[model samples]
Target: MTTITTRTVEYPADGLTMIGHLALPAGVDRRPAVLLGPEGMGLSDVERRRADALAELGYIALAFDLHGGRYLGDPEEMLARCLPLLADPDRMRGIGHAALDVLRTEPRTDPDRIAAVGYGTGGAVGLELGRGGVSLRAIGTVNATTTGRPGEAAHIRCPVWAGVGSEDPIMPPEQRNAFTAEMQAAGVDWRLTVYGGALHAFHHPPVGHPVVPGVGYHPRHAQRAWRDVVDLLAECLPVTEDLGA
Candidate 1:
């Protein structure tokens, strides 16, 4: 059976209680911990599965909820709620730091090896944390469009890996190019992977979305993205024999 734990964490920012799923590999001590920021729809089953998968890899993964507890099936409604949160940069950064703190404080987690992974809007929030000097070992984002231009990219201390779809309408080629250019100019160590023919939220399975025609599930890209994430974490957060299996 999968070895994991679950609990609720109260966000001190807004007194919001976020359900967090903590997954750890058995027979591991003081493993690196990853703070997972869910996509715009909030913490769904997919995010929980991701936590479990990461745990299997011997990392303590904590999936934190950005939304209080509301899961809206309608795309428009989800966007309505998500957009406002993104608009306030301060609030977004606050939430990201709070989530990071929760993961760092976990008894099973190694504070020095902490990292973060986020989806969509959550990706932007993770970028903000990096920019704010959160001291993370690495940060990975999926279908995210919130990182600032290259001028400010120099502020990011941790390595960042971003995954995007070639056909994503929200983040087109020009924007991706600009982001790449900025990262290059800032001298930040980063990598951008473009999956062919994938759309926004490609990792998420089909669901109702009035703005988009197809659902957000691309199995090939999703699997590849997960692999890249694990690889990045392993590289950035090295495990000593005491911490490794």
Candidate 2:
């Protein structure tokens, strides 16, 4: 198994002191990087482990925070904080850019070879970064069905891949259609995958805390979703040139 190092990172964004997790692969060689985002429930050990996993794969990874330094276990509280954040493009962009900056500052990160991979509300932020003209190599998201403003997607300079549960009421067929329509209209390279018999947040693992209505986990689909995202990254930003994936 490959060895990696991890640390806590403190940065300011959206008028708050944001603390994120930074993970780096062994050695000092610069490598392709990922801007990882947490779910709407905010940053937790789940995201930290994800960052460490990415590091073990030889990519400099930063799992950015959402609710400053806190994780919201209460579904209601999570919704209260995320609902407004997800609805505001500028705010989302601000957070994404701040996190990107932090990732770029890492000595082992190849700034020009970076992708944004996120889940749920974090996924929405990744999309917003694309829409806001961030120079990302690619974007991969799960359970995010955000439709950007007209013509904004033209600014996206890379391929995008998204996944959602087919039965997700929060991101039903109509919402998916609208999101795909926007992508097509802007000529952005994009694809969507719908996992049948799954519900909202199906890509997420089981949580000890209460979850929102319509949110559930499917172990099979979750593993598949992770592979899909990894494949997208491999195709768009191959980090194996430095270390194994």
User: Evaluated with TM-score, which candidate comes out highest?
Assistant: 2
Q: What are the clash counts of all predictions, listed in order? A: 1, 0
Task: Please report, as a residue range, the 10-residue window in candidate 1 with the lowest summed lDDT.
Answer: 207-216
Which whole-number lDDT from 0 to 100 does residue 166 have in model 1?
86
Write one digit per residue (lDDT tens) for candidate 2, span 1-245. Answer: 68999999999999999999999988989999999998999988888888898888778999999988988999889989999998899999999999999999988889899999999999999999999999999999989979887899999999999999999999999999999999999999999999999999897788997899999999999999988988898899998777543
Error of 2 at 149 (Å): 1.6
Note the residue pairs that clash in candidate 2.
none
**Would you list the clashing residue pairs of candidate 1?**
150-182
**What TM-score quantifies how close candidate 1 is to the native fold?**
0.90
lDDT of each: 0.78, 0.92
User: RMSD of model 2, in Å?
Assistant: 1.3
The lDDT of model 2 is 0.92
Angstrom error at residue 120, model 1? 0.7
TM-score of each: 0.90, 0.97
The numbered model that scores best in lDDT is: 2
**Residue 109 C-alpha lDDT in model 2:** 88
